[model samples]
Structures are given as structure tokens and as C-alpha cells.
Target: MEHFALAKEFPPASEADWRAIVDKALKGAPFRVLENQLYEGFATSPLYTGAATSPARHGQRGWLIVQPVAGASLADAERQLADDLANGATALSLDLNNGPAIRKAAELKAVAGAGVPVFLAPGSSPADAALLLAKADKTIVGTAGFDPLTVFAMSGEVPADRKAALADTVDAALAIRERFPLVTPFLASSRAWNGAGGSAVDELALTLAAAVAYWRALEAAGLSREDASRAIGFKLCASADLFLTIASFRAIRLLWARAHEAAGIASNEHILLYAKMPPRILSAYDPQVNMLRATASVFGAAIGGATAIEVYPFDEAATEPTPLSRRIARNTGLVLQSEAWLSAVADPAAGSAYVETLTEKLAASAWALFREVEAKGGLLKALESGFVAERLRQTAEKRERAIAHRKERITGVSVFPNLNEKIALEEPAAIIMEEAHPTVDFALPAPGAGERFAALISAAARGVPLAELHSASRIVCDIIAGGALDVARRDAEPFEVLRQRADFALASIGSRPPVFLALLGSPSDYRARSLWVQSFFAAGGIEAVLPEEGFTDVEKLAAAFKQSPAPIACLCSSNSAYGELKGAAAALKRAGASHVYLAGPASLLASLDPNDQTAVDRLIYEGCNALAVLEEAQRILRVEELAEAAGLEAEDENFGAFDEA
Candidate 1:
């Protein structure tokens, strides 16, 4: 009855008709060639259509804009928290480091008095939670029992008395349940796996498996399945891949609902999901681009039905965020909510056939992996057995390879880079310390441990030091005593290293690394590859100095080369023009060029005279390893190596030394 005009005007196109139209558009190319295979055995076709049955609908709306306060002192954190709350932030996340200035009970009171919900990092112990609880009775708190599994996975050192520590944390949660009804005692952080190079499916499967483990533990401690579910929350990472991030959150909700149903929990409560922007994808060189990345991530998280979202400051990778940077980050969400009207719609991607198809496929893949982990004795055992780590490593390696070869582009990193820009780096604030107090750990209390909770509350009331309150217990876990797990290296780190070498050269010798370009043929014939060579050099922080005119004479090219200050030279021209410059490489080397790179396909190397004194030292073309090429260029320019000239033998034979545009 409402606006049926469009549907009545045109008939829906069938799949076969759509395929036929696409085939015509593509000429004779195979349609299957467009299918993309993603990690964790997920593949997406070029097109998707609505199914015979509609997918589930997402009914939630609005997400909390969270600001993380990372300060050296309680005062610094409080100041930032107050400012954020005064602005547009709806929640505060406090990240306490291992400094000696442990937050006192009075300071904790002041923080909670701000009248906003608070989330403490796992670094805070149960004793810390107790102190805050004693001071504040109204505000909701999270991470009462920081999940020790995260610590075990990160540090590879099982905490002493792990079982007792976990029990005490749960008892504390149960003790304060009535006073703090919204407190979440346990956090299942999939962000850990995400930063460690795990794919989206890995993050989902690992988080679900970890949730089951925590639920079982809480149940053994006498908590009902519904209560346990209430006490737990999830933290996931948001990536720049917008649709994948949206689908991921939907998959998580569907999977959790199924799990809850299986557990016979009748409550139709929504799961608490906290999504944070990932720092692994951020770059320090062009941090401005990070703002764009964070914006996209926040959009995806909000559309994906995340309950709360945190956007990392653009300059987060360089230093502690300044006040201005924090404000910018906080306002990003404000603009989205108030101006963009993002919060007005719930599950914005729900009805889209593509998103629904993606969600269904991703959910199925994630559940399969989750079951496999359960069969392998749960998340802890899977991690300890190195099964989870191995899968993440393989995926990370493949991704890194793609990025290094320019198959995947990171703007301002392995692609179009601006070398002249420099940002002022700030020093992190100094940590302040006070006298320490010793902590004591006791045995695991029995199920429904009200007596232990009373004891803990009494101890906290007496001003007992947090360290003394949580002294080591007798329970120990040797299974997690191995070395820490490894994640993939950041994609921008290699290019940043090259930039560092160039910076050192600029500071020490007063000149950045320079590359001379020898152009041939008409401007229209060679302009594209010539600009390609410029961008390729810029990616490595190398300045590509071009000639005023195309040189057909080898002598004239050598003369121009002798006038240049750069030690390296590259040839840029059309395939036909390449035949005209047969002696150009030798002449340039004779003119004091340290190395000559030919900008073309690898097969062009065969066209050169093998016996010539100056055979092409390397080829610069598309899909080559940019990192390896930059390292070799640094060696040639004596930026990294002074004793040896860069050799051609180490370059990729089938490709080139550097990436092409």
C-alpha cells in the first residue's frame, strides 16, 4: 500500500538475465574469474541476489562513543575523562600501565564520581575493582575480573594461582551485582587475536570459544547460564574493510543468539559489543590518512550494531594523544551522530542482499572454526597447541606478501607517498610513583563464595593495599608457560624503516636519497611510466629527478647523468623506444651511475646485451617486492650499507626490485 510504484513499474531481473548482461559488458572474459577467495576459506562472487528466504533482521540502534584515557597519573586521566564527558563521549576506558603510582581509593572515588560508566583495563586487579566499588555505588563498571587468558596469550607466562585469581574476580562480581547491576565482570577480547594477524573468522571463532570457557568457569562457581552471560561482554576490532566489518558484527550476534538458545537461556537480552579501531593498520608517516581509516571503522561499527565504539587518534602510533588530537577523535563520533544521523537507523545494512549473503557465509565459516576449537579442547588448548597461532601466521604472511608486492595498496605507505612532510613527535608524559604495598593471594573459594566476598569488602574498607589483597594462591598452570605468541609485523614498518634511513641521510649528509630518471620517446608515449617511476621512488623516500626532455642520444643522456647528484638511475620509455637506448645503460654507468634500473617487464632483461659492461642492475615493474627494492636502493646509496655496493643477484628474477604504479 505504501509506495508500490517502483515495484509495479519494473519487473525484477532474474539471475540469468543479470549474468547475461554482465557477460555482454565483459565481452568474452569468464565470469568466474571475478570471484575473490578471502581468508578462512570464504569466497565472494562478483554479484549476489536476494535468497528465496529473507535473512534475520537486526533491531538494535545507537552506539556509545567511548574515549580511552591513557595517562601517567590519576590526575591526568581524570582531566581527560572530564573533558571527554563534557564533550560528546558517553563512556570512559581507563588503561592503567605497570607503573608504581597505583590508583588510591580516594582517587578512584573522584573518577567514578564523574557520573559516567567506566571500563578498566585487565591490568587492574580485583583489589582495584573493590576499591572503586567501595567509593562509588551508582556507576556501571566493567572488567571486574580481567580475563587471564589474554595475559597468558600475550605474555606466555601463566599467572601464579590463576584459578584462585579467577574465582576471586567472579566472587567480587557476584558480591557487587545488586549495587552495580550493569557491571560486566568478564571481557572476551577478540582484538588481541585481530592485532595478532588473525582473520575476521579467526577473531569470531576465538572469541566465541573463549566465551564458552568463561561461561563454564562461572557456572562451576555457581552462576546460572543467564547470569554468566550477563557478566560477560565482547571486545572486537574494526578494520578498514567496511562491509566485512559490518558482516562480522552481524555474524557475532547471530552466533551468540544460537549459543544462548542452546544453553536454554530464555532472556532475549542483547549482547554487549565493544569495537575499537585497530592500530596495526595505522601509519606514522602519513597519520592524516589514519583519520579516514578510523572514520570508516566507526561507520562500520555503528552500522554493525556495536554497543560501543572507540576511534584511535590519528597520531596514536607516534605519541600519546595531545588534547587537540583527543578532541578531534571525540568529535568524529559526535559529527557522525548529530550531523550524519547515523544513530537514527538500526542495522543499516540489514536488508541489503549482499550484506545478508556475506553475513550468512561468514557466520557459517566462523561457527565451523569454533566447533573445531571446541573439539581441540577449547580456545586455551588450541592456543597452547599452537593450532590457532599457526593459522594466524599463515594468513598474516600471505597478507604481508601481497602488501609488499603492491597487490594491496596502503595509501601514503606502499603507494602514493609524500616524502617532504614531517610531523612533530611529542614525548610521552613521565610516570609518577608512590610507595608500594604488598599483595596476598589466597585459595580458590568454594562455589557461591559470599563469605570470601565479604572478607574482600572488609579488607578494602580497611585501606588494605591492593597488592596485599591479591597475593598469589597455590593454583598454577604450566600449560601456558611457553613463549609468547607472535603476530604479523605491521605493513608500514618496512617502508618506515626505509624512510628512517633516508631521514638519517638527510640529517647527516644534507641530502635525501635521489634517483635520476632517463626518459626516452615522445611525452605521450612514456609519460605514464615516467610518472609511475616517480611514485615508486617516492614510496621509498627517494627523490626521482627527471630530465627536461627525452634523450634519443646515448652521449647526451650520459652527459645529463654526469650532471646529476644521484648515484642510481632508471630508464623509462615505451617498449619500441627501448630498442633505441641499447647503449644508454652502459653509458650512464660509465658516467658514474652506481646502478641502473630498467622500468619495464622482467622479460625486457633478455633484450639487453649480456656482455655489456653495464647490464641492467635491476628491473622496476608492477607487483615487485617494494621493501626488497628499497633495501637494495639504500645499500646502493650507502644509506644502510657503506662497505658494499648493492648487487643484482639478490633481486627477484621473475619480477623486479621495486613496485610499479
Candidate 2:
């Protein structure tokens, strides 16, 4: 058998050759149009000719399939744990925030004795670390989830005795390490930053800064540099942007290696990176699309060499996760690894020019920002000084503007919405409770942070109820309004609000707010815009009444508009046809249309008569603020006020009208 070299048969193509072809296609458009400017302050080109040099490698073969388990009771958690491990999951993340109370060591014997690594997310309480350490299986391994910095960032509060609380957290982490040698006691996570709408660069810098703070604190408490490094693990969010997500995971590893070098560690020791799917891109409408988003996120994380990955259920945004949703989420990783063989190679994106370049850019930008945070005294100081919050605010505002203008399209929510799809969510099961355990008051007077942690652990060993222990050990921190970051915002929230308003109107008024599409000229002239207009209105839950065919006569169009229930009308046609319908807008206004819109560019206004142009309220075209236009149409139809008058609480009040950009 002869293997032929294909490259020799084809003539070599240079960057110049590609440029010439692209230039011809672009015509007179600037070459810059082919470049994409990211919010990270860098630009990516359309082509790369060669592979990057010396890319970072994860030095591993496969990622752990981590499934999140949350339940209303211990039995529920146990059932989910067994089901997940039996099906496909190799690891478990126990969400203690909403899980059943564990009062005794035997209660968690099932979880710890399951023989798989367990990640304990103890929520905002540092005392929960003591609970886990008391009851955990001695061989249990993974993160203990003692992250004070992230908790502070999310809740905007610090202990009244901040210094003591910090010291106590370090002490608890050290104790955990002594007991469960393989378990990382402290977690340096980017959840707060990522959830608050920070960019990838922001997440990296903030997480690095927090890790650095923890490393120093652990060292101060008498751990060696290497031991301190080993005691901490990282958790980062993997978004749907494949290339960027891959770069982000790779970049964090590089950044951490640099940190190790700075600390005089001889070798770049392994770091545990736990990647999670972010909720920012999930949509409440057409939720099945979330499965696709989750697949992309899991693929990116695996390719970029994550140690573990967790995929959120597809219906998580709309309602509670059903058994089917959980099964699908778990299998998403299983199929990718087992069938796709994505984990068969290490550093799969190593030589790709685009990914490598992006990785470098992200690392450099994040390092610079990390240094900025360090110069401000640290992550905490930056937060207190409002530097971090302000930066996040700017990025969030920019993102919201892009989303409103349709520059950042959210499929199924802001575009291509299906209003008629019936979503039948399964009702959550009623939680069955066991007999209550008698509460024990294990109060200690004026103990130091270390002593308090020890007492909590001892109490847990004695089978004191978790609720009682939590109440006894609760730490009240001062609330800092100026330093608090906003809550996690979903990209589809604004449009979902409009849909809710329309639903309210339909229930109260026997119809959805309608928009009359007064298409001009023949079907060939207005067909495209008519469909576009209908879909656009459907996104905002408005029913667009499109004509079967276009009308060249203004009088006929106005008569149709008057006969319809729509209070708003939009003229849809070709630019030349729009020019031909000189009195269309004026006629619609005269026919009792409260507002009239033109479906072409504002440049067409020059061709219309002065009276016709003056009668037009707005222009509906690509790149316009669709949210604002929809809200205006809703206002013209009085959707909100009418619902209110019918004794319905208008949900749109929570989301104010989007400012037109």
C-alpha cells in the first residue's frame, strides 16, 4: 500500500494568497472587519497559518465525571448518589446548601463509604468544614469547600471579627489536611466573579488573587510553600464559547504555574481544576437547547484538561431538575468521553494557533490584572475600595447593551422564540422527613476562632443536630452595600420578562398584544421582511398579524389595520417599495393606529414625504434595540396597565424599560 503525501500535490498557499481572496470577497470593506474585538481588550484574526509554539499541557489523560447531588433529605441524596455512580458519574458534589441535615457520623457513612471522591459544597458557613471533617470517611478525597473569600464576595459580608474568622478558616483547613491527606481543604473559586457577569479575564485575575491570599495565610499558619499550594484547589466556570472556554482553562493553569515559580517551587506541581457549566447562558424558554450549550462547555473543559467537569441539567433554569434531565446531564460527559474519545489525548488544543494565541492573551491580561489587585493590597482591599465591583459593572453594562441591541443574540429567548410550545414540567416530589433529633446546646463562651472550630467538630462527633450547631456557630458579618456585586444575571432574563407580560395580557384580555404588519407591494417585495417582522414580534410575545399578500393601495392597508385588533402597525417592504408607499404611515395613523413603524433603515426616511416620515414613530431594522421597540409597542397596547387593572401583578415592573441605544 502506498501512502501519498497530499500536501505535495497541492500548491502551497501563503497568507498573502488568502488575503487576496478574502479582499475580493469583501470588496471595498476594510480588512479590519474580519477581526473580532473581544471584551478582554484583544482582537482575533480570521486566519492563522501555523501552530503555536510551546503550548501548556495538562499532563493528564482523562477528566473525572463529577455529578452534583442535592436533595431534600439524606435518603434522597443517597438514592441520587447511588444512581449517578451506577450510571456514569465517577465523582460526587454534595450540595450541602439544600441537602438534608447530617447530625451524626453514620448519617454520611453512605456518602463517604461510597468509595468515590466527594466534593462538599458547604455553602457560606465555615463551620460546615468541621461537620464534614467530623463525619467524613477517613479515605474521602476532594475539596472541603472552605472558601471564605468567595463567600464574602457573593454575600457582601465579612465577619464582625474578620481577623479571627480568617485565622479560624485557615486552622480548619489545616485540620482537614491532617485528617484527610488527599482532600484539599480550601477552595479558591471563580463562581462569584463569573456569576456576577465578569469576563473571563476578570474571573482569572480575581481567582488568582484569592488563591495567593490563601497561600500566604496558610504559610503564615506554619505550612510550607509546597504544602500550602497542595492544600488548595480551583473551580472555574466553563461557558458555551468553545475556543474561549478552552483558552480560559489552559490560561489558568499557566497562570498558576507562574505563581508556583514566583513562590520558588522547583517543579510545577499538579493543580486540581474542577470545571462547572455556568448558568449565565441557560434559557428558561426552549430549554432543550441548553443540552447543546452544556455539550460545548463539557467539550471545551475536557479538551483544555480539566481534572473534573459538572454539567447542569437542561431544565435547571425553568424548574427543578427531573430524573430525566439529570440522566441526560450525566450522559453528556459519558458519550463525549466513551464514544467521542475526547479524553484519549492530552492537551488536545496544544498546537492550534487560535487556541494557543488566545491562551497567551488571556494569561497576560489576567496576570496584569492580578498584579493590579495585588498592588491594591489584595482581593479584599480591591473589593473594599470598589475597584473590582466598578470594573465588573462596566463589563456587565456593556454586555446588557449588546444583548438589548441584538448584537449578542440569545437563541430561543431573544430570537427564534416558539410561543406555542407547551412545556409540562414535572412536579417536585414532597419531601418526607424523619423523626426530629433532640437539639443539644453546645455553647462555648468567648473562645478564640481555633477553639470554636475545635468545639464545633467535637459537637458534630457527639451527634449534635446540624441546625443547632449552625446556629451556635453562626458568624454575622457587616453588610457593605458599595462593595457588593450584583447577583447572577441570565442573558434571557430581559426577553423572558416581556414574554411573561404578554402571557398576563393574553390571560386577562383574551388576546396577546398585536402588531399589524402593513406590508406594501407584491409578495416578492415584502415576503422576507414580513416573516422577519413576525418572528421579531414573537420574541417579545406579541402577535404580528401579517397579510397573506402585500397591498399596493394605502387605503386598503389602512382599512385592514382598522379592522384588526392591533394598536401598533409596521410597514414592511423593499426599500424601493417603501419609497413608493409615500402615504402608508400617515394612512395607518389616520386609521387609529396608536403608533407606526417602518421595517427598513432610517436612511429610507429621506425618500418618504414629510407628512409620512413625521407619522412614523420608529424604524425596525437589524441592529436596532429590539427590547426597546418591543416595550414601546407593549406600551402602545397598554399591556402592563391593562393587566394591572384586571388585578394581575405585572411582572414587567421588575425589569424597567430598556434604554434605547
Candidate 3:
């Protein structure tokens, strides 16, 4: 069969024609209702036509499947690494913080053998990493010592001797570079910035600023511009939102080109872009759904042209990931690469009108913000001045507000929650929590500018500890904030708190918080609202007990309500049925319901008897505050007091902490 040029078979429709049809269908609703405003202060159109012009791909199409390896001991870690490597992982990223210490250089060697890239978290012993890679052949090691500024921003305390730490880090990088050409010992990670509630543009800006600051430091230490650029790498957080994640990755590349051009360096080499899933979006209550979240992140990163990607295990929020969870995460990447054929297309998002437009806007906004940070004396100075912290705090507050009001939905958490679902978590043998170091938030004055790269490298080569390379500071500026910046949080946090209360009720009292559904009229008339009411209650971990059958007789409905284990009842029905529900609502209140909620449009309840509070206490409908509604449900169910006590014990400080990749 020959191609018939099918598009020409129909006449093209104009924008005006489409608008007329939409407006007529909308029945007097405004056209602006279709516009979706993003947190970035921009609106996304509902439709697109021709493709927008996109930048050329400066990197490879394929991404490394960076898997996390952790265990109780070095031997355990080594075995875990071996299993992952043999299964399907292309690279390994270790979380040595919580696991047993890697006390010997041989341990690192045993975990990562040869021809694979290994990324270690910041504060990991660079000396050990250098020693291990010294004997390995073509193994790429990513060291985090070079990026102490991130640690400073996160912990709100600078190192005792800032200049010495900087010099030591540069020296470690120089030593590693000399011994193992594949090792990139310097990193500018945006993990802390993004995880601390910064937007995509803010994260990109801060990352670029940090990269620029490091480049200058490296150059001052005697490395050539090309070498300095090559020695530094980036780690950014990937979100579940598809277009934002894709545009964010692309924006960073464009920003990188501009950084090199501004520095008068003409290099065409692609910089390392490691994409890690943002822990802010993961939920502990519905860990299985986290798999879908991770998949979305990986898909976005792969399409956005990441050099490497790491997908956190779904059970990371609850406990150590079981072997099954680990394999699921690793194979998620494999299936995307081989079966989905993602690697075959370079810049998969390129030329997409929506993506290209978003990328250009993101780059422009990020560049402007980066310039602002630079103007505030670069990333370090801005952080010290509390500018960075203030901006992030404001954004976090706004996001939390949106979540509380139900403007932003977290599925299986804030919406359609399964209160009866059993959570599966592999209990760790021991959870080693890191103790906070006692320190003041004072900045030290530089005693000396710092040693040159050669001297530092020579010192490192002689087995000098990186921390002992410099002199103590003479100047102390007490500019540090009182506590660490708040961790990136999810919209489901408030609702999850409710679930905790329900769990407490079940464990302590042998029952879940219960809410009775007083569904009225025929199945077809009230079934949808009945299910809606059920889901709404479930979000608060409250068991919504519905009648076995819809009732026409008000006495039967009242009788069923009297038998319910809950003191709270919600009436679910159509507008016509609700108009006749005043008597039924009064009967439920008489049946011992402490509170009666009508689940429908608020307009339906506005005409009901205002004098009779017993008939209806409030309205439960879309756009109402979910947190408030759930709290009320808890109060009526008598679980509020129990929940309050349980919340304190259930707090997981590791909420948004991600496994280093």
C-alpha cells in the first residue's frame, strides 16, 4: 500500500475554529480554565503544533545504570556489588555512610573491580578511594571531597580550616588524576540544593555557580582550564514531572556551554551529568507505588540525555531494600534501555515543541538566577549570607500549603489511599544513625591563600590525611543558620501523619479509625459519590464502612448507621437525592453520629437547614482542605489524641535523604 498523505485528506482547522468549539462545549466556562500554571511561575498550554528548534546533542545517547550497593559489612557490600554487577548494572554507587565503614583500601577494590564507574558520597575518605583506584585498571572513581561547599550548605557549618580543606581536596584530585586517568575526583552536586526545596531553575543556577567557583579554584591551583573543566562533574536530582525533568537536564547542558564560553575556554567535550531520583517524591506508606515514581524519573532522565542514572529502591523510605526490590530497580533501567530502546535515540526530547520551549525558558531563568548568586559573591558567600536558605524556605512553604489545600495531589497518599494495604519492609538488622557533629556556625578567616596543586598532591602522596593539610582560620564570622536547611518534603506528609494515627489506633485499640458511609438512593445515583467518600476517608487511614446495599428507606439507613463502629458518618448521593437527605442526615445524627458530612458540591448543602447542626456538620467536596477534613475525621473517630502521640515516635528523619549516586 502506498502512502496517501492522510493529513491532506481533511481541511486544516484554525485556532479560532478550535476555540469556538471549546468555548461552546465549556458551557460559559472561561478558556483560561484549561491553562495550568506551574510552580516556576509559567503556564503550560494544552496543545502544541510544529516542533520547536532544539540545541544539538553534546553527549552520548546511552546512560549508565548506576545501582546502589550497601551492606552490614565490607564483605557484605562486596558480595552485594558482585551480585548487582553480574545481574545487569553498568556501574555502582555506594552508600558507605550508614553501612559499616570501609576500613581498608582493599575493601573498595573488592567492591568495584575494573572497567566500571564507582561514585562515592561526599565525606567519604578520598585517601582510601585514591589508594584503591591506584592499582585498578580503567576504573572510573567519582570522589566528593572537592565539593565541601555542598556539605556546608546542608549542615550549616563550614569546615574548621576552610582553605586547608580546599587545598587538600584539590591535592586529592590531582593525585587521583595522575594515578588513574579515569578518576574524576571533583564534583559539584546539586543534590542538597534541590533536596532543600529549590526549584529546577534554582537548583540549576546554584549548581552552575558552584561549578564556576570550583573551576576558578582549580585554575588558581595551576590546572589548565580544559583540565579543570574535565576534572569537575555534576550530580543533579531528577523529578517525576516529565517535562520539567527533561528540560532541567537540557538546561544544564546549555548552561555548561555558556560557562565555558564565558571563561574563554573552547572545549567541545561533554561534561558528566549524573541524574539521581529526588527523594522528596517518595512515600513510605505506599512503597510499591514508589516503583512507578522511580520509573518515571529514569524515563525522564534517559530522554533528557543523562550520562548516568540512579533509581532509588521503592522501600528506601521504610527500611533497607530487599534483594527483590534492588533487582526491580536495576532491571527497570535495563528494560528501558534494551526493550524500550531509549539509547537508540539521541536527544529524544529534541525538537519537541513543548520540550524545546520549556528548555529555553529554563535555561534563561537559571542563567539569570546563577548571575544573581554570582553577584552575591558566588555560591559560598550567598549561602553564608542566608540568601540561598531564605529562597528555599519560601518555596518549601508554598509547596506545603498547596499540598495541604489539595491543590497538589499525591496518589495513594493524599488521594485514593488504601488503608487496608499491608506495608512490606525488610527490617534492617541495625540502623546506624549518624550523630551530628557539635560545631558553631562561624566562618573562619583565611590564614593563608592555600598551597599549590603540586604541593598538595605531593603531601597526599605521602599519606597525609586530607583534613590535616592546612592551618586553622584567624577570622570567625558567625553567619551560620541555627540548624540544617529543611529537607525536601512530599505533599503527602500531612496525610501520612493521619495514617500513622490510624496505625496507632489499630495497634493499641485493636481497631482502625472508622467512618460510616450513609449512601442514599439507587446504586447508579450514589455509587460514584459513595466510592469518592470511601477514598476520601481512606486517605486519613480511616476505614470507611459503607452499607451493604444502597437504601431507599430512611429508617434502614439510620439503623445501619447506628450499627457502624464509627461515630462519624458521610452522606453520599446525587444532587436530587441530597435535596431529600435532610431527614436522613438528622436520623444519622440521632443514631449517635457525632459529626455528619455531606459529600457533594457545597452548593447542594447551602440550601439545607442552617439551624440544625445535627443534620450536617460540614461539607466534604473537591477543593476543600483535605488535611482539615481528615483531621476532623480523626477527631470524630477519636483517633486524634492517639495519633498525636504516635506521630512523635514515627518520625523518620531519613525522609528525603537519598542514596548517593
What overall lDDT goes with each candidate model?
0.74, 0.80, 0.72
What residue runs in model 1 are displaced by over 4 Å at the alpha carbon? 1-14, 24-27, 51-56, 98-102, 122-124, 138-145, 159-165, 425-427, 430-482, 487-489, 606-614, 641-661
Give the 10-residue window scoring lowest on summed lDDT in candidate 1: 652-661
Worst 10 contiguous positions by lDDT, candidate 3: 652-661
Per-residue lDDT of 542-571 in model 1, one digit per residue for the tens? 888778998989899999987776678998
Clash count (model 1, backbone only): 8
Cα lDDT over the full model 2: 0.80
Higher TM-score: candidate 1 or 3?
Answer: 1
Please provide, for model 3 over 215-278, each residue's C-alpha lDDT reduced to its tens digit, 9 standing for 90 to 100: 8877887788988888888888888888898888888888998899988878545778888988
State which candidate, 1 or 3, has the greater lDDT. 1
What's the candidate order when arranged by decreasing TM-score? 2, 1, 3
Task: List where candidate 3 sits over 4 angstroms from the true fold.
Answer: 1-6, 51-55, 122-145, 160-165, 424-479, 488-491, 551-556, 612-615, 640-661
Reference-based TM-score of each model: 0.89, 0.93, 0.87
Give the number of colliding residue pairs in candidate 2. 0
Question: Global CA lDDT of candidate 1, please?
Answer: 0.74
